[model samples]
Structure formats: structure tokens, C-alpha cells
Target: MIVLPYLQTPRARIRLAEASDAPMLLRYREENHAHLSPWEPLREPEYYTLAHCLKTITEGREYALQDRGYPLMAFDPDEQTILATFTFANVVRGVFQGCHLGYGVAERMQGHGLMREILEPGIAWAFGELGLHRVMANYLPRNERSAKLLAKLGFEREGYARRYLRIAGVWEDHVLTARICPDG
Candidate 1:
């Protein structure tokens, strides 16, 4: 597993969410509940509670220890506000050095290139520090924003996964994409 670092970007910092950040994490979920519903799984209102946030952060730490994954949060540099989360999940080491990517940006943080800022170093750390050779991401076909970001990050659109993901409780189609570290 990789030791999480505070990644500096032009507009934000990306780092691991701490137990102390439970309140802010809960706030992120609450504020983006409606705005993220379409793209995210249906969450109960209380799913964003402090207790849940604390448990999730603790779980993330455990997962990192098992080399299962790393969960990262993006924050506004000036105010130190959590703005988004970027996750590298399903990590497979040994010969199959790879992982899957998942993310969500706070509604207010959208359109300011925060996604790219967080992803650039995140992906680098995946390859450089975690010894990953490939990273994959998938998105609903109608999610133009996600598709664009994957492409912008040099991920190739591999194919469509027919009814592959159960999102919002429905099996939905997704465009599969991947990026291989050239230097790996």
C-alpha cells in the first residue's frame, strides 16, 4: 500500500480523509445528495451522518493496509475545504498491477478543472508509488463529463459494458476505459 501524501495542485490539495474529517465528509455527502443522485447510488439521508463518515474513513484506512485500495479527498487549497473524493479501488498487485478509479466532485467544485488536478497526481502515484501498471474507469454512456475526463487523462475507450453496472439500483450500460503507464 502507498503512504498517502498531500498532493498539491493549482486549485486543490488531494489527501487521505482523516477521522477528524468525518464532519466535513458528511457535509460533502449531504450537500451533494441531490446533485449527485443521478450519477450515484441512492443513499439514505442519514448515510451522510458523522458516524457513517467515521466508519467509512476507518474502513478506507483498513483497506489501504491490506493493499486493497486507497481513498483520497480533494480540498480547496485556500480554505482547506473538502471538495471531492478520488478513489483507487480493487487494487491487484503482483503481476496484475492495476486498480479501478471512482470519484465524485462537490457540486460547487465542478467546472474548475478540479477533477484533472486531483487525477493527474493520483494516477502518477498509482503508477510510480503503488507499482501499478494499469488503471481503469467506467462511466454511464450518458455521462459526457466523465467520458471526457477519462479521455483527457489518456485513458482509452476500450468498449461498452452492456448492462454492466447497477447504478441507482438499475443495471446500466457503461463505457469501459483504461490507461496503461507507458513507462511501466
Candidate 2:
């Protein structure tokens, strides 16, 4: 197994998703389905099931072992509930040495700076341990909060893509941004 270090902030704790997290992951996705729909692709009913979550976690572990992805979960310390998820996916080595960052903060946890706290160390791990040279994050133009957060994290606006992705069953434009590894 790929062991990721635990990260703690005043309000949250971040760690890699494990097989035991399947049930909670399912609940988290089900609870946040409506809140996240506009920002994600349309999901089939089975996407929110425990079986799907289990499979996802299993695949995530295998991907991590192969150094292709890292799936992290941020939890509310007091409530012991998942407050956010961050995925560093599509990792490429050799000359590329980069990955795509995808994240979601729970509806109730928005505006709390929890995602930022979770990302700080997660990005550090990508740069420091994973040895990635760049991390890219793309967001819808309409997501002002996401834009602000990316900017705050030192991700420069790289470009805009027209019809870059299918979100909520419709083609959507995206603002691409990236952060280079400081030590690379």
C-alpha cells in the first residue's frame, strides 16, 4: 500500500482514502450529490452506492501504489465526517511530471477555508514526495470561489478551454490554472 502522511489543521484532518472508508464515502457522495452536481458530470444511481465507493477506494489504492494518483479525504475532527475530497490524478512521469487536481468541499463546509488547509499539505506531498513538476486545476468560469482559491494557492491562470468538459450533462467551458513545484 502507498502510505500517505496524515495532515492536520485546526478544524480538519486529511488522509488517504482506504477500503474501510467505503461506507462513509458513499454517504458523503449521496449527501453532497445535489450540491456538487453543477460541478461534476451526471452520475448514475449506482455511483452513490457502497459497492461503487468500495470499488473506487480499491482502485484508488492500486493507482496510488502505481504512483498514478492519490485520493485524499479531509475530515471534520469533531464530527468525524468527511468534509472534502482531493484527487491528484492522471499523474505522468518522465518529462511531463505532472498531474490534474480535482477537489470538492462539502456544502456545509464551504467558506471555512477547510479546502485550502487540506490542499496546502496535499500539494506539498505532490511536489515533495511524489516528485511532480506541475499540478493543474481546472474549474468552471462561473465558480468564483474556486477561482479565488486557485489564485490564493499560487496557480497562475494558464488558459481557457471551450467545451472542455461535460458537466451536469452539458458541455462547459473551463479556466485552466497550474502551480509549478517550487523545488523542481
Candidate 3:
């Protein structure tokens, strides 16, 4: 099984979200709604609700239990505030031994390098715990921040996709990138 309270940095404590985290997550989503919408699947009206946050956290919990995904969150040291989130989703074992990564930082915390600190150890944990051979991360072509971050983290661009995913209610193309496990 995946571990919890996986890593800690001066600015963040990275782990899976718990039921008690619903309020903090709801606040983060509500506060950063506009900032994230353009890069994310369009949100429904109920997505802003406390109930929706709780439900999603519960689903994340189930995903971890099944070894299908790990929805990790970077919380402040006190665990009262969320700093960022990254999910190692679509985990596959056996021949594939790979997964897809999706992440976002809180709007107010942008450009502070908190995501880097959180992801460094988090990615290491994925390679160690899951023994994954590859982790893929994709982003819209216009998302220079993501493109740069992934590059800095050693994710090499592999290809481009046309109309890859729907974001903010529109189909958007994406740049595909992947990082091989150091021990792969």
C-alpha cells in the first residue's frame, strides 16, 4: 500500500488528503477557481461546495487503497493550509509500470518554488514505493510554467497531441513529457 505523511520540507508536509482536510481543500479550490479553471476540466457548480471536496477526498482515499492512484497534497507545516497538490494517477503495474502525473499549486503561492520542494521528494517516493518505471506529465502548450517546471525536473518532451483534453469547456492541445525512474 502507498504510505501517508510521505515527506516534509521546510514549507510543506506532503501526504494524501484526509476527510478533515475537506474544509482547507474547499477553500483552496474556491480561492483559486479562476486561476486554475483555464488549465483544468471545467468545474461544475457543486465543485465549489464543501460536500464536493469531501467526496473527492473520499474517492482519493479509495484510489490509494486500490493501488490505482495516489492523490497527494502538500499542506502547510501545521496542516491547516494546502500549498499544492500532485496526483500519480492511472498507475499500472507489471509490464507497464508507469503512471500519469497531474499537479497544481495554490494561486497565492505561485512562483515561490513550493511545488518543487514538494514534488522532489514526492516523485522519489513514487519511484521507491511503487517501483514505477516512468511518470508522464502533460500540459497545455501555453502553460509555460508547467513546461518549465517539468523540464527542470528532468521530464523530457516526447510528443505533442492535438485536441488532447478538454479544459475550461474547450478542447486544448497538450505537450507530452515523461521522466524515467532513475533506477528504471
The candidate scoring highest on TM-score is 3
Candidate 3 Cα deviation (angstroms), residue 10? 1.2
* Candidate 3 minimal-lDDT segment of 10 residues: 1-10
Candidate 3 residue lDDT tens string, 33-92: 888888899888999999999999999989999899999999999999998899999999
* CA lDDT of every candidate: 0.88, 0.90, 0.91
Model 2: weakest 10-residue lDDT segment is: 1-10
Candidate with the greatest lDDT versus the true structure = 3
lDDT of 2: 0.90
lDDT, residue 85, candidate 1:
90
Q: With candidate 2 superimposed using the best TM-score fit, by how many Å does residue 115's alpha carbon deviate from the native?
A: 0.8
Cα-based TM-score, every candidate: 0.95, 0.95, 0.97
Q: How many residue pairs clash per model? A: 0, 0, 0
Which residue runs does candidate 2 get wrong by more than 4 Å?
Answer: 1-3
Where in model 3 is the C-alpha error above 4 Å?
A: none
